[model samples]
Target: MTTQPPHASGANGAAIDLQHVTIAYHRRVVCDDISLSVAAGSFTVLVGANGCGKSTLLKAVAGTVPVAAGTVTVEGRPRRAWGRRELARRVGLLPQSNVAPEGILVRDLVARGRHPYRSALQRWSRADDSAVDEALAATGLTAVADEAVDRLSGGQRQRAWLAMLLAQRSEIMLLDEPTTYLDIAHQHELLELLGRLHAEGRTIVAVLHDLNQAARYASDVLVVAGGRVVAAGRPAEVLTAQVVEEAFGVRCRVGTDPVSGTPVFFTESVPGAGG
Candidate 1:
């Protein structure tokens, strides 16, 4: 595995901290004794096979899941302690599943992200309009800003959701499989946009299925298996062949990407394995 430079801590030191966190679902434990810290303004990716608690961990940090045994803190404040508006201003989450309003325009969908900033008496201020416009432009959705969400292609819909998150303008963003169903080109496009956002000082944590993409875009990677973190650090350090074999039970070769110098995995089918 090729090593990359260590990521610097965020300006606020740590953005999200999970201390001995445990999550259980329907009387069964999903994650146990999990501890992790994401520095502010850093891009961290979580990778693992399905059912490995990647989404659960993101939910835990987003205050959507009940922690069985630990604490989740955002910027030195317990997540549970923060009120709705306060929490919304500090962190934004893009869940794996979202329900788009029937016949809702893209601009309106993105505008929903600004709900936290709106009040009963004061609504739709210049700042909100600017945030919405900027988000639309940043995600390359300006041309179709007025189009209905259901009328867009899958990639465009995904970008619309990302634009919504961008509209939130939170310092930290938690995304669960942001590139779930897209072609290779769209996947790269989305990740490249996220990389640009990271460069602009947004703390981003995402659960990704593509290890190569995670290595290429993330400044740090956290690998979890069976609901516990098996490795955490630079992608090259954590995404070794041994770790891949152990966590995924597959034989693979690890190499460096010529273009990005990130670790890449080449899976080799073993003889006698079922097709």
Candidate 2:
């Protein structure tokens, strides 16, 4: 029932590359001496234990968090070489926090995505309008375009934020724990939409806590633990029982989902826990 996105891992080469990178928060190093690349048009998910620096890595690629050492290369140029607006045009970050200005209509909020394409002295153009329209349609927010963003349901509100990212028209999207607050069903719905977006050939790098969901949606998975990416590959390859235990500190049975044929994990009873 799902149409595959026009994607091939590494077919278009590296969209973002990090070499010997070190990421820190509050001047304390979290992840250091790391190297990796996000392939063009791939859905890459970072999965691991809480406080494993998954979000920090995603932010490093977005240039939100300062890289303490090494380099982040976007496309073929150094990340630092791009101007702020220029970087915004090629990559967009959707952080864990989703706060819209009070009473701001969805369309107005989405239009803000176009800010990168304009300067303070310039006016909004027809191109900006078209991008907003396209973003609205892509996220299926067209019907609620005029509704206030805060007035929408949790799921709808998330889509509104995603619409703004789409309007930015960045080839790469970095999402940090995008499913954090949604219920089970809504989480599935949002991930399904991300699948559709990937099919259209955008690169996605997200931090997700659910291994099953990550396996279901991600084209490439990075297992983070002990301040680094411990494993990276197709979900079937990297999400083994031992890997899960090592990264997440859980003893589990890993099996393929009956429907999606992706890896699924079920936790086992901890030793000496039940009395």
Candidate 3:
């Protein structure tokens, strides 16, 4: 049975909501009293320095980590109330690192996303096949659908993983540093693709290390520090120089991006600073 709080409706019809959530490992609290929400069809970015509980928070939202206190809800339904397959069909998660099975074809790797939709008696259906094909095409991997996942380049591999998530066709996507380990061009490409996905009415919430990139693509920014949300608002309103310095412990200047008018950060090296 699920325990639901009264008055749980979220702002702007949020797809995911974390209410006073606290997570601990070995009795040491990692995240404390964290509360946030991801609105439907919105692009929300989680930004913080290393070891600030960004990844842990995302894991909690994905149901991969147990919360020590508080509740997580999807469309006002408690996470524990949803079965594994049901949750998989509504929410998809992409971790920072994924190990592809050796010699698995790209198409087969993506097909794993359909597991939630299948049963022991019912095999792949026409809709499943079409979802796979559309996912491959959306990620520009239709040509390499037959290639070995291990043989693909880093950028291609990232796209393949994205294709897998796309095949799930979930309304909410929780991504952990999806642009990690990619070149600058690929990073931009991946973020742009996420922007397009948001425009198409998918709710996207991601933990990103690149503040400038987050500002460029995210409609809302959640700035975290010391396991607490320091600011959450429009990119221009939440990503000030003061927030950057406080969160990152670095001197920086925040400016608007010439192309997008989003907030951008530039670090300054003090004179006589030594590594």
Q: Estimate the TM-score for candidate 1.
A: 0.93
Q: List lDDT for all candidates, in order.
A: 0.87, 0.86, 0.87
Which segments of candidate 3 are over 4 A away from where they belong?
1-12, 270-275
User: What stretches of model 1 exceed 4 Å from their correct place?
Assistant: 1-12, 270-272
| Residue-wise C-alpha lDDT for candidate 1, range 125-200, written one tens digit per residue | 8888888999999889999999999999988998999999989887788999999877899899889888887887
Candidate ranking (lDDT, best to worst): 1, 3, 2
Q: Which ten residues in a row have the lowest lDDT in candidate 1?
A: 1-10
TM-score-sorted candidate list, best first: 1, 3, 2
Name the regions of candidate 2 deviating beyond 4 angstroms.
1-12, 270-275
Tens digits of per-residue lDDT for model 3 on 1-275? 11112222345487888899999989988899999887777899999989899989888878999999999988778999989999888889999889999999999999998998999999788988888998898888999999999999988998899899988887788999999778999888789888888877778899999988998999999998999888998999988888888888888888878998878889985435798
Candidate 1's clash total is: 0
**Which residue pairs show collisions in model 1?**
none
- What is the clash tally of candidate 2? 1
